[model samples]
Target: MTAITNKGSGPIIQEIAAVIVENKAYLSEIDGKIGDGDHGVNMAKGFGRASDRISAEDTLTDAMQTLSDVLMAEIGGSMGPLYGMMFSDMADHLEDTDQIDAAVFGAMLRAGLEGVQEIGSASVGDKTLLDTFVPALEAYDSALAGGADFAAALDAMKAAAATGRDSTIDMVAKIGRSARLGERSRGVLDAGATSCCMILTGFADGIKTRLT
Candidate 1:
């Protein structure tokens, strides 16, 4: 089985943060279509702060914990709390592991999904982040169960995340502020789904690069 050492994986979190920060304007623009336009600004702020605090030698779990803390305590948007809990749960699941293999990663992904579901009432088709998150997790686990290697599973996950994110474009908002817009929300992509795809894809790419 291929695995990546947790000890030197902190830079992956930094790279994820960079991806968020780089796409700040784009994310907010998506949100501006039907909801508050601060999704990108808030996400970038929280991720940027966490990235600055994470060290090159820090473990992936440690870096994620820092990110969770920053998002939960400093950010003021709904996404902050949701993503904070998700990362917190994911880090907790991986806290004791030295090597991140397919099984371990699947458990971590499940934990994160559970965390998001616990605090939020939205379901898979609600046009929230779960649209992207749920399918990505399913694809990753499905790939692993089908005998794919870690890198291959990550590829499956990344593809699913993108597909799920795009799927949101045709979904009417069933929750959040956008729900008020009803049919008007159908033409635009959900901002949460977009960011979720970026995060999952970033994770997949990072893990694939570190797999050994």
Candidate 2:
């Protein structure tokens, strides 16, 4: 297997920051219904820090570790742990190898999702990031199983994650602060799920941009 060089840190942070910045208002709106209404602010603030740190970092794992440190130490609310574990786990998984192939990339995403599940205590269909992440991971694996290339696999995963994020709009909250709203949480999007999709999209876009 040709070891695919990892997407560098700068693009990683930039993509994540761009998505959070672009969706700031929308994320805040979703958080308003079920959370502290500051998901956007807190996320942007944290990713901003991560992006700035990327300039000083040499590897993708370093970027993830830096993001983990910032999120764990500085941010508040449920996101801190959830996203913190995500980057941390991704970094850990990717650190051993100089590059990652499609199968390895699938495992990397699954590790991050597992870490988030560990922290958030949420499962698939919980109307959280798990909703988006789980499907995306599955889609990535399935695409690989179906003999897709890296680019094609990533495309499939992106589509699946976007669908998963959209599915949250009609779902009642089953976990997190949103669960307290009972059925009222329905009809509104899940901010975490939306951000989840954005992350996956950003990741895919970054890789595509680099590979192209």
TM-score (all chains, Cα) for each model = 0.98, 0.93
Query: Candidate 1, overall lDDT?
Result: 0.94
Tens-place lDDT per residue, model 1, 89-208, is 999999969999889988999999999999889998989999999999999999989999998999999999999999999999999999999999998899999999999989998998
Cα error of candidate 2 at position 84, Å: 0.2
What shift in Å separates residue 106 of candidate 1 from its native position after superposition? 0.8
| Candidates in order: C-alpha RMSD to true structure | 0.8, 1.9
lDDT of 2 by residue, 1-212 (tens): 32356645445666777788878888898889877788888888888877777763356677778888889999967888899999899989988576677777788888898898787777777789888998888898988899888888889999999999999988888998889888888988899999889989988876766552
Which regions of candidate 2 are displaced past 4 Å?
1-3, 7-10
